[model samples]
Target: DTAVSQTPKYLVTQMGNDKSIKCEQNLGHDTMYWYKQDSKKFLKIMFSYNNKELIINETVPNRFSPKSPDKAHLNLHINSLELGDSAVYFCASSLVRGGNNEQFFGPGTRLTVL
Candidate 1:
């Protein structure tokens, strides 16, 4: 079974459109994060949650939003998509116990804005 999974592995849309990516983790983790990998392969954390509570929110554009309905699910919604928004978005979860920071990442959703 996949530890973490994301829906719609590939998403292609035009600029100004809105889209969402769903993510779920079966690892019983308390912390989760939304990461964006740019073309240069630089991974940056967009949002972080612990037990469904917003913890760390990076300085990403306001158009990017992270919603956590529960402890096991965290979804990302993007409004007014732009060409610069194209990247591989990854959902990750971790059992933040005793400072153990091993994160399990989903397969990733590649979003391309034309």
Candidate 2:
């Protein structure tokens, strides 16, 4: 069983389409997050939800949105996807609270815009 899993390991699409990436965690964690890693390998925290409540929302574009149906699932949805939005999206989960907490990441979903 996977600790965290994301569907469609790779995605290739046109410049202006709507797409979604699904994520689920089986570790029974209370906090889940979404991160984007660009081609330069710069990782940025996109959004974080703790117990279905949003805890962090970085300076990401409005086109990018995150939804959490429960404590174990968080999904990323993008509208009017652009070439610049092409990046590796990762889903992570943590146990919530404390500085020493470690985030476990999914295999990542690579998005490519043509």
Candidate 3:
């Protein structure tokens, strides 16, 4: 069974479009995170939610937000998408225990803004 999963393995949209990526985890982890990998392969944390509460909010644009309806799901919503928003978005989940946060990453959603 896949621990973490994300929808729309690839997404292509024009600028100024709004889109969303759905993520789900079956590992029963209480903490989940969203990351963005740019063309340079630099990974940056976009947001992190613990127990369905927003914990780490990175310095991303206001247009990006992580919506967690429950502990098992955290979806990313992007509004007024720009060219800079094009990147591979990854969803991860981890069980935080005793400072051990071995995150399980999803296949990733490659978003291409045209």
lDDT of each model, Cα atoms only? 0.92, 0.92, 0.93
lDDT of 3 at 68: 93
- Measured over all alpha carbons after superposition, the RMSD of each candidate to the real structure, in angstroms, is 1.3, 1.5, 1.2
Q: Model 3, which residues run further than 4 Å from truth?
A: none
The prediction achieving the highest TM-score against the true structure is 3
Prediction 2 TM-score vs. true? 0.94
Clashing pairs in 1: none
In order of appearance, the predictions have TM-scores of 0.94, 0.94, 0.95
CA error at residue 56 for candidate 3, angstroms: 3.9
lDDT of 3: 0.93
lDDT of 1: 0.92
User: What is the per-residue lDDT of model 2 for residues 11-113, given as tens digits with 9 covering 90 to 100?
Assistant: 9999889999999999988899999999999999999888768866658989988998888899999999999999999999999666356999999999999
Q: How close is candidate 1 to the true structure, as a TM-score?
A: 0.94
